[model samples]
Target chain A: MISIPIGEWFDALINWLKDTFPAFFGAVGTVIDWCISLFETVLSWPHPWVMILVFTGLAWAACGLKKYGLALFSLVGFSLIMGMGLWSHTMHTLALVLASTLLALLIGIPVGIYAGRSEMGERIVRPILDFMQTMPAFVYLIPAVMLFSLGKVPGAIATVIFAMPPCVRLTTLGLRQVPHDVLEASDAFGATPLQQLVKVQLPMALPSILAGVNQTIMLALSMVVIAAMIGAGGLGGQVLRGITQLRIDIGFEGGIAIVILAMYLDRVTHALGSRSARKQ
Target chain B: MSDDQTVIEARGLYKIFGSRVAEAREMVDAGHSRAEILKKTGATTAVVNSSFRIAKRETFVIMGLSGSGKSTLLRLLNRLIEPTYGEILIDGEDISQLGPSALREIRRRKYSMVFQNFGLLPHRDVTENVGFGLEIHNVDESTRRKKSLEAIQVVGLEGYENSPVQSLSGGMQQRVGLARALATDPEILLMDEAFSALDPLIRTQMQDELIELQSRLHKTVVFITHDLDEALKLGDRIVIMKDGIIDQIDTPEGILTNPATEYVATFVENVDRSKVLTAGSVMHRTPALATHKDGPHQAVRTMQHEDLSSLFVVNQNREYVGLVRIDDAIAESKKGGRSLDPILQRDVPTVALSTSLRDMIPLAGSTALPIPVLKEDGVLAGIVTRAALLSALSKESGET
Candidate 1:
């Protein structure tokens, strides 16, 4: 039996890439840092109550304004996070999630559309999406930290890679789910490929694509704790500190804040997705 | 190649679906059977050697049962499915080898198609779906809306313009599909079993509406159907397809009266010939006629000479007058009457040359004399005797 040195070869490849493209990685890090800070300033600079009101309004609108449940959930959930003295940390975690999920969608949707349109495109993209999803989040952090160094940018990059598969997969599913006869109708009408995609495919796929966005946001939030190990400060950092210092109370407080944030975000995004589904 | 009035001319059309299209096509051309070709080359030749010409403003129907290639043949006309080997000429230009952009241009400018399933966008309102084609052509918004509304009116879906397609009934949804196809005002309309999904009552109403629309619009239509009656009702000429080959191409009456093959004969075996065969196709040419100018003596002599009980009287201009029986003519002649009008029986039923045998049957049953079939100009073209009508009905029924 022959023993393979795949891990050794992969390590050498990573080192070579890091050494070869320092400038490229530095530019990417700068861009990532800029987006994350922008989100953080917007979220935290405002009084926490004002942000809570805004979020509650969004929930109200998403749930069609008659239902007050999601709105009330957001109001109470954010107040609890604030009362725990974890408001700023929660905002930072949210900023990281929003930025990473935004980046993931921007990259995922067009690639998904391409993959959905052609057999060859799908065949190549399917395995890449699988690898992105099934590979452990911590493994991505190593290469990301090596490339961009231990910072919020590297954590954000790792979070983006971990969270993007759902976006790509769901978008592809949406495009595929459009009926073949509808596609024939479009072709019969002399629609250009671009016209067909924008006018017919994208609108029909909206519900599924928005559902993908919800999944991406949830995955990004899950990455917060692992992201803290690489010096990205947020609720994850507080949780890490609580763990290292053996303070059960502090760890539990951080954990409660994360749960409240996840619950609120899920309701808001899920409402929007379901509303679009009804439209389709 | 095409003459002036030819809207579409298909030459040697073949569509073989499989990985080895070229091999399959060769096998098909070499006279191999479909099953044999499929087994040998892993290809199913859906449409084989289809060729025909469709004239402008003509409703040409392609009819076949399931798996008989009618739908595939319809798609090939517009190049929605590319042919493995063939030429489709639109007005004289071969569309088979045209590039993608050129084909798209032809589709936009020359052809608009409706589908069996209605193929409407569930998310869109009726107006938006109808306006889709105009928008694709970059028509200005106001114009597109106006044209869309006009098309909606054309399809009798006026009030449902702003309603979402999903909210409408299936019949109304297909109206939107029809309006969508009509919005572009293309020269040709391709309908692939467009009414098959509708209920029978709605399907009949749609067919009547289609016929009325054709009378008004004069658009060349290529329709496909599996229903024999639908093909008979809508087609000016129908091509019967079987096992990827055209069994016959003929008028509804021609298909019924003179089936080109045993397959066609079997296919049309159950059709009601009385409804399809016209009086012109069944009537007999009159042997001799008595003119109204001539007296009853001439009528009696002609009736006697032609060995007939009655003679149809005509004017000098060959206008139909009436039928004069031999007994009435002889009695009038014995009474010394000079004219046949006083004794002629005008109550005999008259029909147009184009009247269906179904209509002539009732008239034939009622009348003792031969029913006169008049031309459009009011001249007696021929006569449908009771024997002829029954024979026409029973004659083809026995053979088919």
Candidate 2:
């Protein structure tokens, strides 16, 4: 049977995009790079004990755990990463996750709000969101590599693309699920559209939106080792190096550090979400 | 009422729910039934050609069973649901023609609404929820707090100001909703089944509180409900809706006496007529009353003239003192008493003009003399005779 060379065509399309959108892609690369470096610098500045104290204090304050229980739990978790001697690598992974999550939220939330507010926006976004979510996470790296090249920026970009769907989906769901009567009440009170969004919709939808944020953070964390494949240095790079060199000890240590970091992020964000839910 | 006194007037309002509203409206104009239109065009007409005027400071009720569009009409008044075809005038301005911002301005400044489900922001505490309208109006924080506190007090929700709305009971949540609407002090309040979700006891209490609040605030109110008793108790005039069409518009007493349609008659039928019909409604003219200064002979003469045994005795101020019987009058006159006070029986049953027939029934049945219905000043307004009371009760029961 006569067949189209789809792979070749896809390559051509990627090349065309690179050629046509050099400035746009470069600007995105610079911004992502700047954000990642900024977070890495700040997170690395604290000594290990200082970092431990600050994070524990934050967990204690944010979650309001009695007797500093969550803070103590986070202390053990962070200590495990340091004990694995993957402290710098773990911080790099955290910087990557933070950058990607921040970027995803910045882009996703407004788009989600637009989708929530209008039928047309929802119609246009639904299939795109489905495609973005259902596409293999590895597929994102292909475009990421072509557009921004193999580095932390491309890895962060890929992570953002992979992590963003939940933020968008949950934000739309949250806003849409705001009780119809509440919206009607807001409208009857003569609230401006902007006022309604800021004062009523956002506050009411905070729990769901926070859930979306938590999911995005976890998703970005999960992308850490995978993102290491494209020159993004972190605990992910150590795991990748271990895999290529067949070093079981390095891979095990990297894996352990990633798990502890994941557990810490998961607990803290979940606690934050519950606090918002309680307020609601 | 004059146009200036009409705070809200809806003319030819129609709200057809479907994408093909134009076609549905045409079908509606062509006299298609709601079912037929829903079947043919997949359109549900929520409000159909409803027209009514609410006088200033009057509590106008729109009442109907579920799926009857009474709530739809309430939303239509505030332009929350834009009419498919028609105009609503708020203080003589065509709201349907208003742009988004202008409609919003009217909503913020001229009208506030309470919701059936309470519609309190779950994230907000009672004070924040109550102060929402004022916050929307950009009222200063101190003013908002002051006004919201006053409104909270008005709804008897003091000390609950900082409590989260979700933690409150249904009745308390609705109080917050009411307080929110009141905090704005808007000219009009649109309450869409505001207390329907509360338990019956709380609902009745809220209704009484609203009635008491209305007397003091005197804001033009458009209240929606399915409860006929609430309609009767709260409405100065009520519009009964059926299948998106207005079945009748009349005062509670007028609707009870003369239902404009069979649908309205059925609604009136289920209502407790005793609770609705008042003493003044069933009461007859006051019987011949004698002044305390009148001679006992004159009292007997007047009683003899009226061909009765007993008579109501009032002071010169027309204040009811007691009743006098012909036998006593005769005895006193034979005894040569100048004042009829000796013959007066001061313990006759009395009720007020506003007393419901349900309350007066026992008094009317137990009293030997006719029950005297008094005004606020204790003057005899009318008399509810045994025959009159029986006829009124029978008249209502016979209709159903």
Candidate 3:
């Protein structure tokens, strides 16, 4: 039988990449760490009640003037998290999710636009997105730890990889769905390619793009919890601790906290997506 | 926009779509059929050696059925679809040789287009959609607003300017599209099936409004349509296309009276001729006209001698006044009236010389006396009796 030693080759390649790009990887890690800490500081600066009030206001506004149910749900959900004494851990998990989602969008949107504009770009980027999405979430942690070492930074990086595919795929889909006659009209009226994108394509594609953003936030929240196993601190760490010690009480508390946070984020972003689908 | 000067011209244009354009061009030049050329060279020839010049203020229409390359030819004028091998001259500048920025300058300042489906931005209100071209030109916001408002009023959509385009009816949306094109005051207005999507009633109303607007604006217009009637109504000159080739180009009346080919003959063969032929074309000279100087005795004698039941009354200069029937003339003569004025029927129907025979059919049918055809100056030009109208209808009646 023909034997292919893929594992051995991958390890050799990783070792070489680490040796040759020590400064490069360190720089990337510093940037990511800075982003996470920045959010973490802002999140922790205000008192918990003040933060709760802010979230409540955002929920109310996102659901529009008449819809206050989401705001009430947010208020009750955050107060319960505080009552459980898991406030700081929830904040930490939030910082990671926000930073990862921000970074993913920054990179994914431009790639999505390029892929959407050209067939060759889509063909090249599609299979890679498929591979990133389908690979088990736990499989990349070993190499992540080997490369960046155990910290919030590696966890955030892994979270970024896990959550980026939807952002790209949906951006491409949104742009592709623009009517051919609309594009042709823009061209006929002397709009440049850049102008067409900004004035017409982007506006038309916004709802789909917002849907992608909602999906990314949900995926990032899930991946951050999984990142807890690699010494990343948060409610994820508390859940990991409960699992190792066979403490159902601790596990359920951390699980409930994650659920509340996920639901709040999902509702806020979902409201945003649907409201932008049409204009006044 | 100088008179008699060509504003747009195309020379030896050819558009063959596929990889081997050179081979396709060769086959097209060698007179191969489109399908044969496509099979041999994997190319479809969209326009083949087409050329024409549009004069200033001319409503030039390119007309054909679907897949006849009428739309493609319109696109070629603005270089929206580049000609495979040709030079397009606009005001003596060859657009084919101009660089991208130069070409954009021409498009931005001098050319605007209206699309078939309106091609409106659904997210924008009517005013914003109308101002789209001005915004592209980087016009000041105040000026853009003022210009767009003017265009909106021109298209008779004044109150709907602030409404979202999606909320408007299809006809209103199309008006917004037209306003968008006119907002820029471009020298050339390229309309590609602009009114084809509207239902028939709205389409006819729009066509009439366009005719009114054209008389006032006099912009050089290149219009495309598949409907023969629309072409006849709007086009100062019509170019008929078949299989990516120009079959004939002529005035509508010229084409209707004498078709250049069997294909063009078939196109005009089914037309309702009453809609095209004017009263002037069918009217005969007034055989027995009575002048006011002639008394009822003279009028009655002329009518008796001419063997007619009715006689048209005219003044000394031969300007039409009214009609005097034989019975009224006899009664006036019996009463010893001095002139035919007392007995003249002043409320009789009179038609303008330019009114189409279709619109005059009912008037002709309802009146027993001849309908006087008067020129724009009210001079008595001719008269259309029922017999003449029927004869006119019968002579030009084709398939229908």
Q: Which candidate tops DockQ?
A: 2
Candidate 3 similarity to native, TM-score:
0.88
Worst 10 residues of 3 chain B by lDDT: B391-400
| Cα-based TM-score, every candidate | 0.97, 0.93, 0.88
lDDT string, candidate 2, B65-178, tens digits: 999998888888887887888899988888888889988888888998999988878888899999999999999999999999999999999889899888889999999999
True contacts kept of each: 0.66, 0.86, 0.41
Task: List model 3 lDDT by residue over A156-257, tens digit each.
Answer: 989999999999999999999988877877878888778889888888888888889999999999999899988778999989989999999899999999
Cα lDDT, all candidates: 0.90, 0.89, 0.90
The CAPRI category of model 1 is medium
In model 3 chain A, where is the ten-residue run with the lowest total lDDT? A271-280
Q: Per-residue CA lDDT of candidate 3, range B1-400, in tens?
A: 2359899989999888899999988888898888999889898899989988899999999999999998998888888888899989999889987776787788997799999998888778899999999888889999999999999999999898789999988788889999999999999999999999999999999999889999999999999999999999999999999889998988887777678999999889888778887888778974679887899889889889999998898898889899888898899999989988788888998999879989998997787778899999888999998998887688576732
Clashing pairs in 1: none
- As a whole number from 0 to 100, the lDDT of residue B368 in candidate 1 is 81
* CAPRI class assigned to model 2: high
| Candidate 2 wrong stretches, greater than 4 Å | A1-6, A65-70, B1-4, B19-32, B286-307, B310-347, B377-379
Question: Which residue pairs come into collision in candidate 2?
Answer: none
* B220-339: candidate 1 lDDT, tens digit per residue: 999999999999999999999987999899888888888899888888888888777888988888648888799988888888888999999888889898888899999999999999
Q: Interface Cα RMSD for all candidates? A: 0.9, 0.7, 1.4
* Between candidates 1 and 2, the DockQ winner: 2
TM-score leaderboard ranking: 1, 2, 3
Summing lDDT over every window of 10 consecutive residues in candidate 1 chain A, give the lowest-scoring window: A271-280
Alpha carbon lDDT at A78, candidate 3: 97
